[model samples]
Target: MAETSLEQIRSRVDADWNRIVELLKSKIALRSVSAEGITGDHMKRSAQFVADELRKVGVDAKVVQSANPDGTPGAWEVIGSRIVAPGAPTVLLYAHHDVQPVPDPTAWNTDPFVGTEIDGRLYGRGSADDGGGIAIHSGALAALGDELNVNVKVFIEGEEEMGSPSFIPFIEAHRDEFKSDVIIVADSGNWSADIPSLTTSLRGNTCVDVHVKVLDHPVHSGQYGGPILDANTIAAMLISSLYDANGDLAVPGIESQEPVGGLQRDLDESTVRADAGVIDSYTLAGTGSLAARMWTKPSLTVIGFDAHPVEGSFNVISPETTFRLSLRTAPGQRPEQAQEALAGFLESHAPFGAQVRVDRLENGMGWAMDPNAVATKDALEAMREAFGIEPINKGEGGSIPFIPELQRLFPDAQVLVTGPEDPKANAHSPNESISLSGLRHNVETEALLLAKLGR
Candidate 1:
């Protein structure tokens, strides 16, 4: 892994980088929105695109269909190839091909599905969030020249954006086929454009839908304004009590810890407020350090509120109201415990005379990786060789949902989170973009990683 040798290989890759960019752009052009109204044909095309690319690179790749009848119509594909060299460690590369719903193409400067390159940056709906990573993985394997020491398995799910509902089952059923020594997730981003990162932890998530019923029907506000029990008011109070004035979670029995590793960068309050379109500059909720509050602390958010609106102006006391609550639990916290704690809080704190019902929507455990694993060390070495920078250890506030499942299924496997995304990529937002430099760094690092593991 001499620096000169690495540079020569990287320069060769740079010469043909435009073709790689074109491949990524073509993949992004397919709208594989998994959330709603996503047809099976969309996933088929996406999977086929990946399979074709893998095959073109001389990898023995095929689309393994793991469709769920009760779930989405699409199937999860695992495309991979093993190196012929003796004693090469098997590495499983994971990424998702699905994109979130593009609600407003009008809000974007270019077509959401059309990948655009301007000023050396690739812009599209899925470019940075995941498509960039997928492209980098494919290009890295291609750069490896088809023969290496380590076996590589690339698993791309078509439903990660939709919570990966079918992924765990697919893995459970096909555990033997996808066995590996290490699993690398190239989905998260670096802290910033110049900063490299490795995600060591992911927060768990639990969603609960609550319904409050006070009366059978809406009553005239003019007639029953004072005496009528307003379900809306009760629901609002209950929601308010979800957190205290200090922004600490009001739910009891939920554990919180101080997060280690990295500090969350502070954004200008004005920037946050402007992005949220808040007229008033209100202090953000939650206590303690931002990373601790977000990554290591439990949080309750009111995701949706279903009630009568002021526009309708039927000054009526609503009889029934329903709302959705999402809670982010710290790493190592059980989702079931968090769910129970939240349910208990809502049940015990509900306003008097209001019947409350709590229904759990989904629950998933958090994941924490052992950062000192051999694969992790090898990745760090490869990254330092490729980028001349040390990778930062960070924790994502979001949940992967399937990570814990993977760990359970492969207890001895090393898990690594590496990707091409940078902080400014603006994933899942308007004008989403990926840096060509970051993509190049990722390709080189991945190539070095394969080489190092092969040794």
Candidate 2:
């Protein structure tokens, strides 16, 4: 497509391979975990690190800061640009510098903050999620150098792991800077290690914390348990009502979309069981095709419950119970619609006239890309050529709010989602890691995509 040959690009990536790993390791060691008790300093440093790296690839980069959703504080957003092809379409590469927090450090085999390489996998928090993402983008740019076919704009967000509460505002402030004909989100995963994938759909997300109070004060369970309804029991009933006998979402009026891309009807149960660490005794929930259930249909999960701990041995039948419900909406379902439907279901299904308070926490819209769109077509061809295999068009169950937001902001731009994460990556879990070979292939794919699209 350009003067650079595929072999030359591959050699460049191979030669500077250690540098890419080192950069990712440095990022992982920075402790840029999503703002738990940590301040914005680490994320700021991480953004600066990305900016500096981009600058090394013949681009000028800068760090931008803003507020979080609560207006307390937010992470940094690193941006940079290089105009290799003067009049060619500008391609925006997106990756996040932030990462999910390690729930328990003791559970990890290695220090989650330190990037450790073992068995060709880089282990650490953020190493795969977006740190590997940052490396992929930078590695691609390094391969192209100043001869890139398209004008390049790199955006490494700092609050992705925190659900990107400040993302829309950041985009609003930098409207012109984010302008582009194509936007590639380097934050999703491939189908497998050797098999590449193009994420064509992402599930939307909506959640609420439901608190049910049965009595104003605690009552002796031994004396009055049978006569009064316990908040815990009512909460359990409400949660059970969320699904029908077949384990499908029982919420009325919730929307769902048919599966796209001729993807497989059902996901391999054996693969899921192995990857998810499901026990042999555990039964798979939900009805219908697994892929449809995962990527194109609504699913409800009771993430947490707050009640008197059994360890305390408090026989209190009275008081309150709270539970958090995480809902994954189908690709075409509107966020507002899903939220309204869920809220209505909970409000109407309060057990035995119990007081039910459903507090909506967050809702993000899902996105779907036209598989036959010009940009999507170009990406498929590039991936096939780069990976030497026909790429699989897949749908992801997770939500990336920025996808829909970016689509709204850049109506004409083609937004492509690709990354190095495989199902075995175990992102957000203890012992998270990335495949070195997969990372290299992803880098090759992006570099080739840029060249092909520009040409």
Candidate 3:
């Protein structure tokens, strides 16, 4: 908050940027994919790698394997801490070490596990989604070195990509370890590589697998095509029922309205189109500003399907089909409420008396931060000082399920969600990346925030 009295921290981050990049590359080299059955020993090794890295910077770090709901020892989580004084306010830093499963590694321009620096961007699977987050905290801490003042605690969970299945139990078992005056979730993105942003709200999320059954067995298309609709066609009809002609959600109980708050910043249409990779001539859906459409409004997407492939010639009509829907909720709406409304609408809209069932329901709550919170002010000042530009405020369309839980667990702590990602990061997709300058500024911003809090 003071006039760049912490300029030394920024200089230090700049000096150590290359070393920080190397650390991040080492992290990206580990394939810690934690998606369901694909999880393996790489997760444990990744956690240990992060722990060892933290310890090297003078933080006390260790690895813990928490159990899932089924009572099996689950993924690894890294917990690290450093104490300056008993009187200093404690700050908890959060990031995930696990990455999403690479659907097709061959689709990447380089190896998904290798961090590639091209045109000033570091590209890799985990390079941005969270690997940059760990680098941000580590870079700041290393720069501060003997100047560090506040007590610091770090939680790097390995199951975030799998919706953090065991995070709640893990937190419940180690609650005291995370008690702090401030919490920084470094898992969100900036407005752009040039403009820094603070995520003021995050959309909640729900997912379900729907089964549409039209017949007991597959039938010949030539014989049954006249009167009966195949399960695939019927399933499409049911999904289309969820949206109106304008592409807004049509469910009755699900709320969809323009936001009246949250500093919904202006986003250029061309930038949105380019960032989302929307094809030319394809109009954007929903109403209101692009920011609100993404962050405050509800959206439904068919994430996966179980239909037949076109490779083999099929003269038969499929009798049954299953699809997965990922629904994002508005700020105030609960994931359960949205899932219920969606389920009801789907069952009622079953085409031609087809049997419809919604199964495998999963949900995570959303969150909104006060624009005038003290910690937000501190962070904004930190960003301004680091980037030398007025930072923008935005909300995340994606869900970090564990953030709301951390809020519920520590009601008094100020939670600041900021990170090194930008619109071009393309996290969770192939070719994910973070700009080198953005990463460096983020490290400076974090260091300034810590220094301000210490003061």
Work out the TM-score per prediction. 0.92, 0.96, 0.95
- Cα misplacement distance, residue 302 of candidate 2 (Å): 1.7
- Give the top-scoring candidate (TM-score): 2
For model 1, how does the per-residue alpha-carbon lDDT over 180-236 read when each residue is reduced to its tens digit? 888888998775566677777888999999999988877887888877678878998
lDDT of 1 at 434: 92
Each candidate's lDDT (Cα)? 0.78, 0.85, 0.87
Q: How many Å off is the CA of 252 in candidate 1?
A: 1.0
On lDDT, the candidate that comes out on top is 3
Worst 10 residues of 2 by lDDT: 34-43
Our tally of clashes for model 1 stands at 0
| lDDT-sorted candidate list, best first | 3, 2, 1
**Clashes per candidate, residues 3 or more apart or on different chains:** 0, 0, 0
Pick out the ten consecutive residues of candidate 1 with the lowest summed lDDT.
260-269
Assess the local accuracy of residue 65 in candidate 2 as a C-alpha lDDT between 0 and 100. 80
Alpha-carbon shift of residue 363 in model 3 (angstroms): 1.0
Instruction: Quote the lDDT for 137 in model 1.
Output: 79
RMSD of 3: 2.1
| Per-residue lDDT over 122-176 for candidate 3, one digit per residue giving the tens place of the 0 to 100 score | 9998999899999999998898887788899999989888877888888888988
